[model samples]
Target chain A: MSCWETLADYALRSVGIGERLLPRSDFTICQQVVLIGSGMIWNVYFGVLALCSGFFLATAVALGKASHSVWLRKPSEWFIFIFRGSPLFIQFFFAYFLFLSLKQVAPIFTPFTSAWAGALVVLFLNTAAYSGEIFYGALLSIPKGDTEAADAYGFSGWARFRRIIWPTMLRLAWPAYTNEAIFLFHATTLVFFSGFPAQQQRGDALYYANYFADKTFNPFIPYPILAGYFILLTLLLIGLFGLVNRRLNRHLPRERRAKVRFRPNVIR
Target chain B: MFSYCADPDTLSGLTWLSCYLTTGKHMAFYVSFGTVLLLLAITAPTALLFGFGGAAAARARFFPLRWVGKAYISVVRGVPDIAFFLFFVIALDQGFEWLRHKVKCPDWDQPIRQGSDFVVCDAAKLPLGNAAQWVHETYGFFLAVLTFAIVFGAFAANVLFGAMRAVPHAQLETAEAYGMTQRQTFWRILVPQMWVYALPGLSNLWMVLIKATPLLFLLGVEDIVYWARELGGTKTPRFTDYPHGDWRMWYFLVLLIFYLAFTRVSEVVLDRVMKKLTHGQATAGGEAQRKAA
Candidate 1:
């Protein structure tokens, strides 16, 4: 078959769009590229959704960790510790097993046994914990004069936090948060590789790369293709996060601006 | 493993629980934790060495050597290490076999890559095809060690590169004034000073390495995750005397707790080490210590 037909059939195969069956044997470079690129759809899906939703919890978690009340601080501390201390791989296995047991208990949880819900949940919590720690560190490093200036302006409580504290915390955290975001996207590859089952042979880029590697017994081609896709994804992520970083530090002069360089810390 | 385990059916309550925990598979589960620790113990120094080489080579006078070094460091930057892990294992395995095949069977007629199969002469197989179970496992563990070292070495090289540059220019200038050559200055002055700057990144990398240990199961190693799944799956009465429901979750929870405690302890120890390192230094941490004293 032609490369165009192959692309048409497998371009959206990862999301179960065009192709129902994966290339079985005599795999072409076109099939590997199309299918692996298709698989990137799931990686982006997991990364974007988890990072988007994880942001809110991460903000709350950062605030909780910074709170004066022990009641609030303890849970936040333990939550961050539990998720951050343990490997996300183990967490995925433990969670899948836990979710499986819960599925036995209730029908509503059956979806959680699959990679989409279950691994996303794991990635969500994992990124939140890492980002929360970054934010908490940012919170502590916020200049004391900012809060004092806020009090002089009749800002207090939530108003003070929103006006003075939070933005500065974000600005300070943005570089490291960008790193977290990169790692989180990279961590999405772990989703299908983990205990969570990828239903109907639909999986992320790494999953397809793994499949093609197994079939062709040539890791050279498929793995590099997957890497190329990820490099593009990472570049896109950095460009996107760089925009946010710019907006966050918009007030700062050029010399003072923190550059969003690639600082690769993996698995949080 | 115990006398009571001999007749698990007759046992009950705490005795049954004790016997269940002492079963052969459960013993492997416990041993797997040691495997993780061993991997860390072996990989850490090996990776640090690899990273140091990469970083030094990146700073080399030769352009090709520098390019190779830079490539080594940046290869893991945008890519997932898991993908690298999966790719490298098979690639390296086949690579070694192909090299051996070339040397061992030069007269062989068939091409090595036939369709999807990687056909090497049996004589050229790694560890040999009929090698003992332990030899095969050791070969696998060795491959895993090399893979971990190669991947983490890149991260470490990045950190070490930054640290090497972070060393004060005045120090290197002083070393030159004292007639120290570049290599001598690098080994004696720069390496010593760079560690302080490198410690923070190295510590973070160490934690990441600790967390990455579970991926060993994916490499087909019988690490904790492997044993947890094997032992935790539901066992019927036909399979064993002490039958139980699905207990994989509980086993995983145990693995979870083990990691938490391990990281917590590492954090405490690392903090103390950082304090000791910074005690008389001129960094922010040292200033804080001085003020406190």
Candidate 2:
């Protein structure tokens, strides 16, 4: 078939849209590109949804960890430890099996078995934990002078937190938060590789890359395409985070405001 | 493992649980945990060596060599590691085979990549096509180790490069004034001082390296994740000696506990090592130790 026809047929193939069966033989570069690109839709969906939701949850967790009350601090500590201490790969497997058993107990909650609910839940908790640690560190490192200044101005409790603590925590945490966001996107590729089944053959970019590699007995093409897409996605994420980091550090003097340096070497 | 535990069906309750937990499959699962430790033991030193070489090359006066080292760090950091795992395993396998084909089967001259087939002469195969299963497994484990080393070496190189830079410039200048060669100064002053600066980043890398051991399952190694899924699945009476319901949840929970414990222990060990490395250094940790003394 022509490249256009193949594109038309397999454009949404990852979501089980156009084609009932994946191309078995004579796998064209066009088909690989189209299908893998289609599969990227899921990766983007998982990364975007998880990061957006995880951001707010992470902020709450960071604050909870910083709170003076034992009630607030302990649970947040445990949550961060549990998620951050384990491998994301195992988290995916554990979450999948947990959700599977949950499904058995309550078929009404069968939605948990689907990647949308199950994997997203895992990603949400995982990122929240990681980002929580980052934020907690930032919270602790927030200038004591800032808090003292707030106290001198009579800003107390909620007002103190709102006007002083929260903004400074975010500002200090933005660089590390950007790193977490990038790695979380990288982690999303592991969703399908986890125990979470890709029902209807609807999988992510890595999933389809593996599929094509297996089919053609050639790992060269499909994986590189997936890598290319991820590079683009990662660059886009860097750009987005840079904008936010700039805004967060806007009030600081140019020398004082920290730049968003890429430091993937020191993994969380 | 016990004489009394030979017959599993005869046991019940806690006894049954004891025998079940000590089964051959479970022993392999236990060994897989050692496999993770073994990977760390080997990969850490090998990656460090690779990183040392890369860092040395980057700090070299030659422009092309510096660019090559910089490229190694940047490219690996740029892409997801899973992609590298997926690509390198196959590419390395094929590259090895192609080399063997050229060396071992010089007379055979058909194309290697005819459509989808990567056919070299039978003699050119890795492990010579008739090697034992253990050899194949060992070969795969070796590939996985090399892949891990390459990816992590770049991170280590970045850390080491920074550490090299962080070494006191005055020390190097003093060595030069004393008529010490560049190599002598690097060995005596730079390398010694760099470790103190490198320890924090290296410790963090070590934790990451520990967490990444589970990806061995993706490379088809019979790691803990692999065995957990295998041994935890529903086993029908017809299919096996012991029949059980789906217990993957419990199995995965056990894996989770294993990883958590591994990470916690590593954290303790790494923190101690960092303390030892920082002793008498110019950093804050060293200053704190000096104060305490």
Candidate 3:
């Protein structure tokens, strides 16, 4: 078949949309590219959904970790420690099995046994922990003078947090938070590799790349394509985060504004 | 291990648990933890060596060598590292076999790439086909280590390269003023001072390396994750003496705790090391220590 036909047939193959069966033999470059690109949809889904939702929880977690109350502080501290300390690969395995056992006890957890719910939940918690630590560090490092100024203006409690502290905390944390987002996106590749099965082969970019590599017994092509897609995705994330970062620093003098350079060593 | 424990059907409580945990397969499972530690032990130094070489090459006077080193360091930044782990093992295996095929059996070449199969002559095979089981396992382990070293070396190179630059230019200028050769200045002045700047990044990299140990399973080594899945599956009484319901969650929980505790201990040790390393250095840590003194 022609490459165009192959693209049409397999473009959404990973999601079980266009092609019912993957190309078994004579796997064309077109087929590999289309199928793997299709699989990126899932990666984006996992990364975007987890990051957006995790942001609010991470804020809460950062605050709880920084709070004076023992009740809030201890659980938040443990949550960050457990998630940040353990490998995400093991976390996925542990969570999948935990959810499976939970299903036996209560059928409400049946969805949690699947990759969709289970892996997403794991990524959500994992990103939250990493982002929480970044925010907490930022919160701690927030200028003492800024809070002192807020107190002088009678900004108290929630208003102090909302009007004075929150924006500054985020402004300080943005660069590292961007790194967390990129790593979290990179980490979405691990979901299928864990015990979580990709239902009907509806897996992520790495999953489809793995599929093509297995079929062709050639690691050269598919992996580089996957890498190229990820590079673009990483650049896209940086650009998107850079826009927000600029807004966060808009009021600051140009010299005081922080540049969002990609630092590679931030992953826990 | 206990004589009464042989009859697992009759045994209960601690006795039954004792027999189950002592099974031969369980011993292998326990040994796989050692495999992980061994991988870390070996990979750490090898990767640092690779990173040192990469950083030095990046700083080389030759343009091409510098470009190659820069590419090696930056490649990890764009892609997911798991792709590198999966790709390099297979690629390296084929690459070695292809080189061996050329050297060992040049005249006897049927094409190496026959459709999807990488059909090299038996002599050109990694462990030479009929090698002992341990030889194959060792070969596989060696490849896994090399793959880990290469991927992580890039990250370390990035750290070391930045650290190298962070060593104040005035230090190098003073070395040059003293009529020191470039190599001497690099070795005596730049290298010694870079460690303080490098420690935070290196410690962070060390934690990343610790966390990345589980990816060993993906390279087909029967590491802890493999054992957890194998041992935690539900077994029938007909199949084995110690049959149980799916206890995979518990097995994985134990693995999780193992990693958490390992990372926590590493963090504590690393912090102490950083303090020691920065004791006399011209950095913030040193400044703080001076003030405290």
lDDT of 1 at A108: 95
**Candidate 1 vs candidate 3, lDDT winner:** 3
**CAPRI class of candidate 2:** medium
Candidate 2 residue runs with Cα over 4 Å from true position: A265-268
lDDT of each: 0.90, 0.87, 0.91
Error of 2 at A254 (Å): 2.7
For residues B35-84, write the lDDT of model 2, one tens digit per residue: 98898999999999989988988888899999998888888888787877
The candidate that wins on DockQ is: 1
lDDT tens readout by residue for model 1, B95-180: 89999999999999999999999899899999897899999999999999999999999989999999999988999999999999
lDDT (tens digit, per residue) of candidate 3 on B1-293: 77887678998898889899998999999999999999999999999999999999999999999999999888765568798899999999999998998999989848777777778888999988789999999999999999989988988888899999999999999999999999999999999899889989888889999999999999999999999999999998889988899999999999999999999999999999988988977788899998999
Looking at chain B only, the TM-scores across the models are 0.98, 0.96, 0.98
Candidate 2 lDDT by residue in tens digits, A1-268: 9999989998998788898788888889999999989988888888889989998899899889888999999999999999988888988888888878888888976888889888998999989999989988999998989999999999998999888998999999988888888888888788898888888899998999999887777898999898899888878988998998888888989999888876654223
Better of 1 and 2 by DockQ: 1
Error (Å) of candidate 3 at residue B11 is: 1.5
* lDDT digits (tens) for residues A1-268 of candidate 1: 9999998999988878897988899999989999999999999988899999999899999999999999999999999999999998889889999999999889899999988888889989988998999999999999889888888889988888887898999999998998888888888888877778878999999999999888888999999998899888888888998999999889988999889877776654
Task: Give me the TM-scores for chain A across all models, comma-separated.
Answer: 0.97, 0.95, 0.97
Which one wins on lDDT? Answer: 3
Rank list by lDDT? 3, 1, 2
DockQ, all candidates in order: 0.78, 0.65, 0.71
